[model samples]
Target chain A: MDEKVLLTGNIAAAEGALYAGCRHYFGYPITPQSDVVEYFSAKLPQMGGEFVQSESECTSINMLYGAAACGIRAMTSTSSPGFSLMQEGISHIAAAELPCVIMHVQRGGPGSGSTQTAQMDYNQVVKGGGHGEYRLIVLAPDSVQEIFDFVQLGFYLAEKYRNPALVLTDAIIGQMKEDVELRTIDFGPTPEDRSWALKIHRSPKGKSANVHSAVGIVGIYNEWLARTNEKYENIKRDEVRFQSMFMEDAELAIVAYGSSGRAAKGACKLAREEGLKVGVLRPITLWPFPQPQIEELASRVKKILVVEDNLGQMVEDVRGAVEGRAEVHFMGVFSRHMPDCNGMIFPDTILEEVKKLL
Target chain B: MSGEDERKLICDTPDCINNTLLPTCPGCLHGVVARCVCEAIDDLGIQENAIGVVGVGCHAMTAGAVEVDTISTAHGRAPGVATGIKRAYYGEAIVFTFQGDGDLGAIGLGDVLNAVNRGEKLTTIFFNNAGYGNTGGQMGPTTIEGQVTTTSPYGRDPAQSGFPLHMAEMMASLRGCAYSARVGINNLKNYAGARKAVKAAFQKQMDNIGYGFVEFLCTCPPGWKKKPDEAFHWMEKAMMEEYQLGEFKNVDEIT
Candidate 1:
């Protein structure tokens, strides 16, 4: 059995990446996610891996692009503003069809909103934050163990489809400590064909391999777009992951993810104790969001409460998924235990909203 | 004799370049610089192990002609990208960035400087065509004082628009930089010097010395509103006067 070690969300992510064979880590330090860079700096070099403390998030993401182009496992981690700086690079990486992992430990934001935990980056991560039509495989992990597990999963999916994968968490999980099992997951064999990657030696194809963002010719671009769209569709069809708790005979459902999902679990228990038939639907894959399940749940449940740490972002997706089949409500930053940047949404507070809804 | 035999080859194209690919502009020296880079790679016998990171602008077209495995990066971010490739290869592969004035001097200045400061084992080939040729003659960081570009219709004024950035000198000033030189391909004498400078820059990386930089003073005919020949003459007289051509720094080892 793999040994279980107490670890913070950030350390788990770093260890997860190392175990997944990610040898190159390029990142800039930002609040709520700096521990990731610190851990990699101290440990990666010792493991004969590369760690670059980039000047900014922009540089870091571009570096990730270059490393990924070489068909190697590489990643970077950042918070809100830093992630915003990475949008352009992400778009380019997506366009080039290179595989890489990015960990966004979300914080409060419109600008530099707060260093504390928040789910404000839901729209940016799920929807295409970068320019052009592109999608990231976004994973939201609620606990340190899940963070550890999902990071390895993120790398697997990224390489499997040759697309960027995002591990989306928040400051609460990033800073909190929990037991995490440290082990290398068997994601099957690595992709056999890497002819597309930049070669250390000349390719057997007798032509130089090139990776560029722009497909300048129109017809080629259309074909590339068709291929990319189909890939995204395949990802959507096969990669939707979520956890349904007490959903068997519930009339009301709580839709949440990441830290908010953890809080909702507690809320569901309290609601059950008070004789309310409430359940929690926690989405693990935020991009190929469990839309089908949400639509199915909307058919069964009369009301769905979308809980998030921000001012209603993922609720839009939930509402769209329900498509007016059921009434959708929202509980956000205002429902936090305290009314400040460091405030958290407690289970009791979520239960109060659950009671008010029913 | 057959037509092929009748036509004696005066000069052979480097094996690392696809000679069928043409330059983006009539008077642009990007093709010349590309050929020189290919020749350096061939001379170093590292064509298979060379990776070029190209930045956005007219210079980006050079990547299409060069045969080395290349990654076209966002504007001005080639240095950062090359740094990653070099580190990932663990100094086993040759890594270099091909960038333009606006890319290396203005938008990506911080990335370039930081990479150099980090003593990254990489090479940078900067094309200074005075203005942004791909964007239709907009003023750039390397545009000479009093140069009239589309953005500076009334000629660049040092008071309003700052002085032209001397990148070779700036790189030389950095402790991490091992080699820095500025050269031009306007004339045969300068063209020879430019080729040598390019080769030396790549050699610096091959020896794992430190950051190496070579700035090429190129011409943009349409951007400067000059005929091809006139542009060459103008570059020799005007551009050379503003930006002196020669090696600014060379070190046996970086301390």
Candidate 2:
């Protein structure tokens, strides 16, 4: 049964993960993401699951790795600094091809910058944040409901590919409350049943599971590269997801994702009322990025405006996706590694940029 | 050949050693340590139910020879991994960690301490070979004063490198630790005691006792830049002098 309720993005994500069959939750407290840890800590145990308040983000990620290696559905959540500490474990889990979900509620930083919401981690989440050639199935959710919904999808993609999945949201989306419809989903087989997981039910005759990253083995890495590359190519071909509005006959396409995309939706309506024919293209998956849809819009639209809260990170990918098919303009507001209460891209601000291009 | 003598060759029951040839350099104590651990698991009759979490360095190779379900953890993260495994399968499986001094003492001290403090029911077999054997004898936390290593070619200075950490003594101080012992493997006499200590550590975990640890003062011939026989003599003379072989904590006294 689906029930309607008011929930914050952080709470929604936790509830969604629970419904998706995440039985093990491990995390350390980080601002903007602490609600997730708190929620899971209380709720998971009540539901006959396990929760561990880890000593550090490094420990939490490795705990998730250990649980996932045994084919258990596990997760961990963090903000920037804590998430940064998890990179080493993430690399190990990826190399071992374990399935797990990690949530990073974006914060401002090169170091311990701010606990405020920001979209600066686009590269860190989509590209490999850790060492070696690895890819995480990254989902960017704009609304509280989507944040709830995408967690289930994140786990699915992780298990589907036997790799890690990340739910990348920022402070605004994570903290903001909204009415959401929560539905319980049935989770699939444990990864251990598929013959790759570390067999938990050990018998004398069963084969022992050998899981390692082989981080610097040149010969072994080539084989890993070939297999991972093929999987990523298939993901690129099948998983590129985007949503567009007012694109039916618009002359300009506004590109954004997550909260910025929500702001762009409002800007598109404002531009259309002023007879500017602006449309919005919001990407749902940051990696396997909505390239083909951007290509289609590039052919139809005369110009593209890419807006973000970061100092022009995703615009590079947008430009590459467009590939000179249209003139791409980047409109990003840079912050001083501090929280931006009003630094988020607003509808008026994006409209102003679109009007300038018009 | 007498028929009675031919019938004396019998191999049965506790198939302790793996069929594969020992995969260690000649005269390395890693082989001896591996044999002792496998023998302990066999002696306890928990080989089928045991799970091994192995750390990096030469100790990582021990997993291949271990007949149990084994997972090689990241360098210095075996205790953390073992903690997760033990918690996930709590009271269902026997979990153990095989780690070297560099993996347990240097970068991974926190993981071991926290797990022990939480009183995780797992056995830890610590190999204090004094230096990082896999990385060509670099200085480690257990590297003794006045000892020569790749990073401390001028000999380990108490001022520069800090005093060698006695992990068995440190772990013994923790209230959560049910048992902690330091044993050496140099002479035939010490080997017998070392086997007893290893067996006791495993038996404690089997009894659902908390956080048992056995620190083995083993030899690294190449790391020490000595011949096999010379390494044994040095272990007897210097290493044993610094790391006393005795049980520091027993469950009957601690808990």
Candidate 3:
């Protein structure tokens, strides 16, 4: 265990990468996420590591691709527009089933959106960032400690499954500062473990290997893509992460993650004070959407409340898991206005529903 | 075919060295710059450790051309990507960029400038071949005054478009920059000079000196709507006006 330090989410993530022995970081200076680049740019060389402020998100991802191909742990971070620029490379990484980490402190949408926070890119993250059939091992970290935890987890799972991992947080969580507990954890990719990665260029016993991401002259490209998708499916099976509170004996559950999950926790506390049976499913890993957990909870719970900063992204997943088994509701505040986590919708506005249930 | 996708090749240029030696036809000057940079890196014995960041435009066409680890970036972003490579993988080996006028001068200009200003220990080979070769000979920031391309059908005018950008002169203004010189490939006289300047740039980095940039005033015949021989003459008559040949900055001079 190391001494605890007050750190920003960006610095916390950088520390986690450093702790995990990730020596390579490729990124461009995009707002909100710049701290991640700034921290490592100075610190990495001191530790004999690699820190690159790439020219664009596109180049950043490609650089990570190069490093990951060498079987080394590499990472990059960006916001909305920059992240979108990364979509193409993200898809390639997912398709190649390479091990790497990317952080997206999300901002508002479309083109050149404000360099501020927004959950508008929710659909982009969980639904497959670039193209083809794939999903990043997405983690929405709310606190500085969780940023550390999730970055560690992101690296662990990425190498564990030989896939890309994304730490998806909003500007609120990224820019905000808090105490980050510096606790060491099992966060390394063992050599025996990552046999599938191309670090050693283990081209199948010298069969004159042609390692390429190109779609084959034949249709192997699609099949190759399908292989990565299949890995995502398998990873989802083993990698689903979420925390369920009071769902076992409750009538309603809040499905949320990251900053939105923080607000949902407050809402749950108030709902409990009002004597309403409310629980929450806060996802630690997003791609493996904890579908089975939500499905199991829905079997007993009467309703599901999805709280998110976006309009209706994660709620759809909650509803899909419920499949009308439970009444699914939503709590959304655009990425602009922070969720009224101060119990804005509990015991007072939704008191009638809680009272009726109680 | 001088496009972003390695759509064209430049390997046929005289005395051009092909590192990949794969089967493809490249633009004549493409192989020249590639060989120059690779030789500089090899002369410093960084072949195994050096990483090349390629930008969009024709230079990006060389994505997988070299055997070394490479990162292909968006247009004009080679310098920034190179910055990332050297910063993260410091002391592993040399880090350099191969970029065209469009990528370096126009789109990725900020990255190139700040990378030099920050004086990051990376080498940049800015290919200042005036016209944007791939996109139907479009006007690039480095396109000379009165030069005609797809965008400027009636030839370039001072009022309609500002003066062509001078990357070497501009980058020379930064104190962080260790070395910068404008060189060329189409001519025998400047080609040797270009090779020397390129080697110096990489040597500056290998010696842990700061940032180094080499801008080559090369030729693009197909893009310039001229015969291949005429392209070299055009390189001589047009590009050398404002972008004079000389060392823009040398950190060693401070001593």
Candidate 4:
């Protein structure tokens, strides 16, 4: 049997990062996500890694840039306001084309609304929060196991694309304890052998004279844009991941991601027992949108229900994917009235919505 | 060594220095400061292993000037970036940050102070040209009283813009800081001191001592709206008086 233990999403993320060969962790303490830093602070040193509790999110993200440029696996985590502060550094990281993982255990937003779970940062994370034209390979995880798994996958994708990747989870999954089987997956060869990485030499006379900057004269910037656009196109074509359940003969489809996806799965089961022909299409990668698969599901289903812990954020993506082939209804809930889990659209509520469509 | 060879050897400019004219305004002290720091790196023979973090400002364009590996970071976040590099590489990479007053003394104050406080073994060369140089002479945290700029057309009033910060003194007071100094780059005498300070900062990092800071009183003629030659004189007469030049603290003294 595999080694399994009850771990919170944050701890699983830390363990996953360690197993993924992350040697540096720079982070600022933030609510609902501070355990990631706490775990790394104690575990990293024992594992012969480095951990820094930075002064702010701005500093921590820049630290991520530095470590990533050295061709080392580095990571950081934060929540709403802290994530806002980190946008500038994230833009710099994207422009410089360095690979690193960033986690956002989302809370209520627009401002520091609350420390409870909320998915208001959907557009901010997937639509390039910083500046300029860029895209993060955003992986939305629904469970403690997915949190653990996505951490390693995030690093792999980050290194593979030479871009920053994010594990976008909300407070419910970040704090919830679940059984996770710890395992290691090999990511083949590291891409740091490229000429852009920093390394020690006897003199600055070799291929190691790397410069990691995004700003330059107009001509240089134009060239950079072309190159980055091409990389994003490849990611869109190759890196999209999602899971479909009971969609082959379903009359209704529920579109959800992250923790909302988990709830929608339960809702689907309840609807099935009640003999409603309902299913779920859970997107694991939010940025690429799983458009083709959603298009197929939309053709087969009579209606689509988009569920989220925020006010219709991912619903837009679902709509775009469905392309009006199916009638898409939004069951949007914001994390304002109660804690994240209670505030969310429960499985029973989702089952009721599915029955209505039926 | 022959006289010519000896002279050549004494010229410690690292090959990493972009031989092309610096992207800075003509007669700007940033060129001199860059040369001095590069020379220091060359002298220490850490050019191969050195990694620099270039802050966003006028210094952003200098990324290509150095042969060493460099990362151009967001404004005022170079110290944090360098801290990450040093932590990642630990003793293998000698990391440093080159930042200006606007980037360092103002926006980056908290990160730099905290990095120093945390005892990160790295080097920081702060270019204090008083006003924001690249941003068209805006007032900064280090803009001295009575110094006139676009933002301070009627002369800098301490009552309004507040006082200029003494970064070296503040850093030296921090427990994690191993070496802190304020140096001027106006003349040969002060220039020599600045060079030594830059070298010493790198040495401290290489020795795994702690955070080392050297604040240079750089001249920004365009920002000051003065001619280059006149700006040098102003830096000597006014800037020197307010920002005292010398090593504020040394690890040897502490030991």
Candidate 5:
């Protein structure tokens, strides 16, 4: 059973790492989420896990690359610019089909943007965020409890599919304090299972001839890409996770994720009080996003408003899934002239748009 | 050198291709250096525990040949990658990065320095062939004195280009590395030294002593626009002047 306790979103994520059997934590300390490192540094070794203060974000993710290659669960957590440095390594893992988890608690920016929170990296996270044809199983957990649960589920899906996984939160979710249950889930693989990892070629059973190489060359990569593409298709077709509130026969379907998801709840509730016949679809897993369901809902609802911090990134995905079945309006406060990271898209800003659209 | 001396050296003759794959240009010096690393891994009987971090440049092609657990890293960050791999699974595998001059010296200087300074328990093999061959020929950070390439059209202007960097020696100054040595791929004496460095790097990794480095000052005849024999002769006389061979640091002796 998960015990109810208050935690900063960063600490909640650290606890999730422990519960999920992810014993290796490799990352450099960055702002707005340093408590994750601080919490895991003390807690991991206590549980006989390994925690490393790597030289940089690049080294941390690459370290995850090594650990995950051996089929062991591994992860790294970072903020904006550090996440930027980690993209190259993330690309390598994605190509290799190595299962590693990354948490990006977005602060603001194109450079060393800000230590404060914002949901600006939706495009970077959901669209592979690196070079080549790849996608992470991006999970958006709005609540502190969901943050803990998805960190574990993210590891399971990553290992099952042999792909990189992501838990995306902004400062809002990463730093929030709320009651969460610390339930133990038996993930069934210890860090010791990765004996060969990057160093040796061994399955848990013992000595076996290992192939260090994976998809990179043309013929080989094509075969792997075919397999990866199938997996991508499966995720889109099979996994469509979301939470619904008053969605039945709703005339307006408001879609959001992460902080916006929380904000949309309030918006939908207000619209309901006014009897405007509105409902909300808040996606828990952001990638292979809940598109088909949104399409189904779009047929009944006249308009779908995509409320996000950045300018209309996810609206395109919603529009593509619906394919002109209905009109999709974007309630985005996009400060394109300034920069993606520094702008603000307040919950009220989205609420005001909802008022006008209805 | 006589034919008898050539027999003793471990060269990458076409007769000696073991795997159906390899990681260097046809007849480039990197083939010899790679074979030495392979031999060291074989001799230690750690192929099962070996992870090779292949980087861009000539070594990018090496990802296919290496039999051990391998991951191709971005340019110049092989050491950083290997450091993570090895540390997260201590005693589980032998981790090393294989890199060339353009990838290591030109663009990725920070990665090497930081890895060395951190004393990460890993091995690094640097193939320092003076000019860039993967792309169009250009003067690399380890380009020899008075050498001509695509970038330096009128021969390397030492007055403007400055002398080449002696990387192992520079790394030795950090005082955190376990072993540091520079060798060559041109001849028997230099080949032996290079192999010895390769072996030492592996041994240090097994011992958990600390960071280790082996620099192979190789030759690129096709890019340099010369016959293989002439390239070796050039490396013999002047390459040594700019980038010296022999041990820069021996941590075992200190301990």
Candidate 6:
């Protein structure tokens, strides 16, 4: 039986991880996402799971690395600054091919920008914040229910690919409460033969299982690099997820994600009532971006308005996807409902931008 | 004795040591500490159930030589990683961290202190060669006052660079540490003490007492600009004065 409960995005994320068999949680408390650590700390021990309030975000990510190396599902949640601190560990985890989930409850940034909501981490997360040639499976959720669902999906995809997955959210969605139906989501069987993961028992090959990031041997390193690149390509091909609405007979498509997507969706509904052919294309997977759908939409529509809570980050991807097939416009953080620090994108403001573009 | 028996006695390598890997530097004591660790695992008869979290440095290569299942963590993160491993196993596995002076005393100080403060049942083997051995002999947190290295051209000015850290003593002061000791393997007597310290540290973890730490004042001949025998003499004569041997903290219970 499934149970429905009103949950904030943070609580929903925690529940989703638990339901996904993530028995180890290592994280440090940070604003807008502390609820996740709090919930895990209170719930994990009772369930015979492990919860570690790590000393820092750096430590937290390394702990996640350790647990993941042990072939167990582990996760950590942090905000912008803390996420920045985790980049080194994330890079190592990726190189080591350890599967883990990281949730970034983004806020304004550049440097301690604001504790309020913003999508400023678009380039940082989607474009690869850490060094080296690597990509994270980025999931952007617009609502509390989606937050819960995406977190579970994140873990599944991480384990399936032996790579790290990121659930990209924001302060508004993280702090807001909504009715969430909690249920186990099965993404089919992951690789059962985890011979690569560290086990206490000696390997049958008469050698210890060593999990490491650096491959010094040139031949082995080349093989590893080839395999990792192929895995990324496979993920991109198989896991491009997005939600399209009212695009069947539309001329203008509003491309957005996360809370911005939520606002743009409301704007699309309002635009339809006013006899406008506006539609919404909300990307769920930011890295495996829905470029094919966007390209298809561009062929039909004359104009595409990309709305975001930052300075036109995702617009670059949209423009690239459209490839001059349509005129792409952007509504950024400056076009919010208010001019104050707590300003957010609202349906009315987005609709106004849509009307001007049309 | 029979020829086969003599050969067996002469080449008695621990089952936990991977014999294929090339040896460490000429006078580096990482090999000594690695043998001591493997010997401890063998003594406890937990070779199959032991896991190691190795931090980055020259000491990281030692993980390749030690045949236990190991995870090579980011520099200075072995404590955090070991904590995760120990917690995931719920003390069913014997988890330990192999780290260097720079890895532990500098970059990973907070992680080690926090792990010990949490009373996580894990063992830590810290090899302090007084400088960053892997990165070409740069000055490290444990580099002694007035010591000269590549980074410390003239000397380690206490005003410019802080005095050497007493990591084992500092760790012992923590309320969560069950056992903390500093030892060396420059001589036969000290080698025995080092083995005993390593075993005691692991025993504390096995008994679920709390965190166990053993710091080894190791020799880094190339990094210290000395020959193998000279490095051993320097460690015994100079390093020993600052980093005294013997256990700083040992208790049966948390209180």
By DockQ, the best candidate is: 1
* Cα lDDT tens digits for candidate 1, A1-358: 8899999999999999999989999999999889899999999889999999999999999999989999999999999999999999999999999999999999989898888888998999999999999999999999999999889999999999999999999999999999998998887775788878887877523777788888643128888899999999999999999999999999999999999999999999999998899999999999899999999999999999999998999999999999999999999999887889989999999898888889
Assess candidate 2 and give its TM-score to the true structure. Answer: 0.94
lDDT (10s digit) by residue, model 6, range A187-282: 898888777877776652466778988754312877888999899899888999999999999889999999999999999999999999999999
lDDT of 3 by residue, A107-199 (tens): 766688667666778888889867667778888887989898888888888887777899988777887889877876885544464333322
lDDT of 2 by residue, A1-358 (tens): 5689999999999988988888788899999899999998899778888788888999888878877877777899999899889999999898888889999899888798777777888988888889877889889999999998889988988888888999989999999999999896555653445566555556767676666766454127677888888989998898777888999988989999998999999999988898888889999999888888888788898899998888889999989878998999987764222335445667888888888898
Q: Each model's RMSD to truth, in Å?
A: 1.5, 2.5, 7.0, 2.7, 4.6, 1.8
* Candidate ranking (TM-score, best to worst): 1, 6, 4, 2, 5, 3
TM-scores of all candidate predictions against the true structure = 0.98, 0.94, 0.79, 0.95, 0.89, 0.97
Worst 10 residues of 5 chain B by lDDT: B11-20
Quote the lDDT for B220 in model 2.
87
Clashing pairs in 1: none
Instruction: Point out the higher-scoring one by lDDT: 4 or 5.
Output: 4
| TM-score for candidate 6, residues paired by index | 0.97
Q: Provide the lowest-lDDT 10-residue window in model 2 chain B.
A: B11-20
Worst lDDT 10-window in candidate 2 chain A: A334-343
Order candidates by DockQ, high to low.
1, 4, 6, 2, 5, 3
| Arranged by lDDT, best first | 1, 6, 4, 2, 5, 3
Whose lDDT is greatest here?
Answer: 1
DockQ of 1: 0.73
Q: Report the lDDT tens digits of candidate 4 across residue range B24-66.
A: 8876877777788878887788887888888878866655576
Q: Model 3, stretches more than 4 Å misplaced?
A: A1-14, A23-99, A103-121, A128-134, A142-145, A170-181, A187-224, A263-276, A296-299, A334-358, B1-27, B63-65, B241-243, B253-255
Better of 1 and 4 by TM-score: 1
Question: Model 6, range B108-161, lDDT digits (tens) per residue?
Answer: 999999999999999999999999999899999999999999999999999998
Q: On residues B1-255, what C-alpha lDDT tens digit does candidate 5 reach at each position?
A: 667756765544321124645545545777677677777766677766777777778766654455655677677777766766765675467888888888888777887888777777788888887888888678988887677889888878779898787889887887668888998867777677787888897788788877789998777777777788887777777787778788988786323
Model 4 spans with C-alpha error above 4 angstroms? A190-192, A216-219, A334-342, B1-16, B253-255
